[model samples]
Target: MTTLVYLETHDGELTNGGLGLLSKAASLGGGDVAGVVLGSGVRDAAASAGAFGASTVYVVEDEALAAPLPQPRVDALEAVVKESGAENVFLPASVLAADVAAGLAARLDAGLNWDLTDLRLEDGELVGLRPALGDTVLVDVGWTSTPRLALVRSGTFDPVESGGTAEVKEVAASFQEFSTQARLVDHLQEESSGPSIEDADVIVAGGRGLGGPDGFSICEELAAALGGAVAATRAVVDAGWYPYAAQVGQTGKTVSPRLYIALGISGAIQHKVGMQGSGTIVAVNKDPNAPIFDFADLGVVGDLTQIAPKLTELLRARK
Candidate 1:
């Protein structure tokens, strides 16, 4: 079998999630694993995929792909899939990736398995593990047709370097008329200090219990002191107390930090699925029966307003 891993890039660098997926495809080991990079000025980023375990890197550099759009990418990916004769295609979940995967599936009339958390080879066939029934259980999923497409959940795998190199093959870019019609007008980057939640080793998340937007000051201070990042639950984001980019839950981003501190969070199943992969979980809530306490490694039944300030003070003092 031949597997094609889509290596998504941003600002001329490969995304950790995409690289991690590439490493996973290589580890499966039953067949040759290749990576396909689609973007303008992405040759350097494509070359780096070899270190993460892509034996072959297909590059399609075109001005049409300069902006992170799905349709043009779908066109490029389809061309590469046909050229490579790949039986399987894998992509990490992202706004652009999700769109591209859906478009590719529709264009190729192939089967797609999405929101997958894990994948393994069984009897020389690929099987994906998808969370079902509110993420309480994992169900096995597979495609009955060839060129199986899968979109995995973010942060499900970590990139491992193999100190190898890939054979770079450039492919000509071609796009359907409808795909090239949409054009990017302006791009604005979010201004943030410190590590992003996805890359942070520690994350301090706030929820509805924080009272309001200002209540996140304690979380910010604690995250700053711990050299981490600040996150928020879906409820907090929906209330406009925090930016949607910082939200963590079923509708938000998935993260697997080394340490996760939940303040005022009630630990709804929607929120738990996003951060359950953290190495160490700690919760501080006044309610003793809060669901977060059930899974937290260290649960403190107390008021977060008081506890969080003291914890931040202690952490800063240690520095």
Candidate 2:
């Protein structure tokens, strides 16, 4: 089987999620593992895919695809898939990638299994594992048609370098008038310091027990001390206490940081499903009976207002 992993780059670099997926796709070891990069000036970034396990890197560089729009990418990806005859297509979940994946599925009349957390080859067939029933259970999913498409959840895997090189191949793409009809008007990025939640190695997350919008300062200070990023629960984002981009839960971004510290979080199932994959989970809450304690590797029954500052100060002093 020939597998194609869509490599998405941002700010002239391949996204960690996309590289991680490419690494995982290479590990399956059943077929030729190739990565397709679609964007203007993405050739340089595509070269790094070889180190992450791509045996071949397909580059589709077009000026019209400069912006982070989805339709042009769909067109480019379709051309690459057709030319390469890729039987399995994998993409890391992102706002634009999700749109392009859906568009490609419709264009090719293929089956798409999205929100997949894991995938494996069994009996020479690909199987996708996804959360079902509100993420309460894991169910196996597969495509009945050729060119099986799968969208992997963000932070589901980490990139590992294989010290290999890829043969770079350039491909041409044709865009439909309708696909190029929409033009990007403007792009506004969220101004943030430190790592983004999805890419952060350490994340200090806040929840409703934080009391008010201003309470995020506590998480910010601690996260800063640890050289990490601040995250929030759906409750805090819904209450306008934090930006929706920083929310981590069932409806929000999934993060698998090396260390996840929760402040005043109740550990609801919705929140658990997102960050449960963290390497180490630490919860700080005043209530001993809080559900967060059940799964936290280290549980501290204390007031975050009192503990957070002290922890930050101690970390600063040690630094």
TM-score of each: 0.98, 0.97
Candidate whose lDDT is highest: 1
Candidate 1: where are CA atoms >4 Å away? none
Candidate 2 residue-wise lDDT at 205: 99
Error of 1 at 111 (Å): 0.5
**Per-residue lDDT of model 2, residues 46-74, tens digit only:** 99999999999999999989988999888
Q: CA shift at 218, candidate 1, in angstroms?
A: 1.1
- Candidate 1 per-residue lDDT, tens place, 1-319, comes to 8999998887789999999999999999979999999999999889999999899999999999999989999999999999999999999999999999999999999999999999999999999999989888989999999899999998889999999999999999689999999989898899999999999999999999899999999999999999999999998898999999998977788999999999999999989999999999999999999999999999999999999999999987888
lDDT minimum window of 10 residues, candidate 1: 245-254
Q: Name model 2 segments beyond 4 Å from true.
A: none
**TM-score, prediction 1:** 0.98
For all candidates in order, the CA lDDT equals 0.94, 0.93
